[model samples]
Target: MTTTVVGVDGSPDSDLAVEWAAADAARRHRPLHIVHAYLSPFVAAQVAVPTSGGFEPVLRAAAEGTLGAAVARASSVAAGLDITTDMPAGEAPAALLDAARRAALLVVGCGHAAMAGLLPGSVSRAAVHHAACSVAVVK
Candidate 1:
């Protein structure tokens, strides 16, 4: 069966997307694949904090935690549903699009309307426009 793929970042909207994707995967009788893309510490440190030897491990741990929470949330929504997770080594939109190549549907979360005017976030917008499969932007 074609799997349902969802992107998560630990935000409230991401939680909603996880719930929606879990339910959809259950209804479709397909597996749910959760993806959380994180940048390399070298790149992330440039954008987030000062470069340090300890930063990489923290980034990896945070990404794993995000995936774990998403898995738990999805499981709560659909008990007994098959679920898998990934932490791809790249940007969010590209990773999601790559994963979507083998997916039945790609799901992403949309933050508050004020955050991006009338459009969805960059990752969601990219998926909505570029994913080979159907895309869902859950708010």
Candidate 2:
């Protein structure tokens, strides 16, 4: 069955998004797809100099680890919730939106748009505007 996708980045609003997504998935009787994409600082740190050794391997590992942790976190909140995780090698918003395209719902933290919870970044906004399915920004 089609599932719901939620993006997590270890923030308060992301936690709320996870809970909300879990409930929504339960209500819909569909699996929940929790996604988390992570990259190393040496890959593309804004304030730090990029490493010269390359970053593809480190980035892939970090993304895998982040996605695994996100799944574990979701399971801790709602055990046996049938959540499948995806860790794509890309920006969080882009990967999330990609997952959302196949999802019944896309959940993320509320961006600081004076509409809902104040997320500290613009990733949520990008996902909300570009998501192919219903977007829910949990407060």
TM-score per candidate, in order?
0.86, 0.74
Whole-model lDDT per candidate: 0.84, 0.72
Best by TM-score: 1
Which lDDT tens digits does candidate 2 get at residues 66-92? 567677777776777898887664467
Q: Report the Cα lDDT for residue 51, model 1.
A: 41
lDDT of 1 by residue, 65-115 (tens): 989999999999999999999998667778889999999999999864221
Candidate 1 residues lying further than 4 Å off, grouped into runs, are 40-53, 112-120
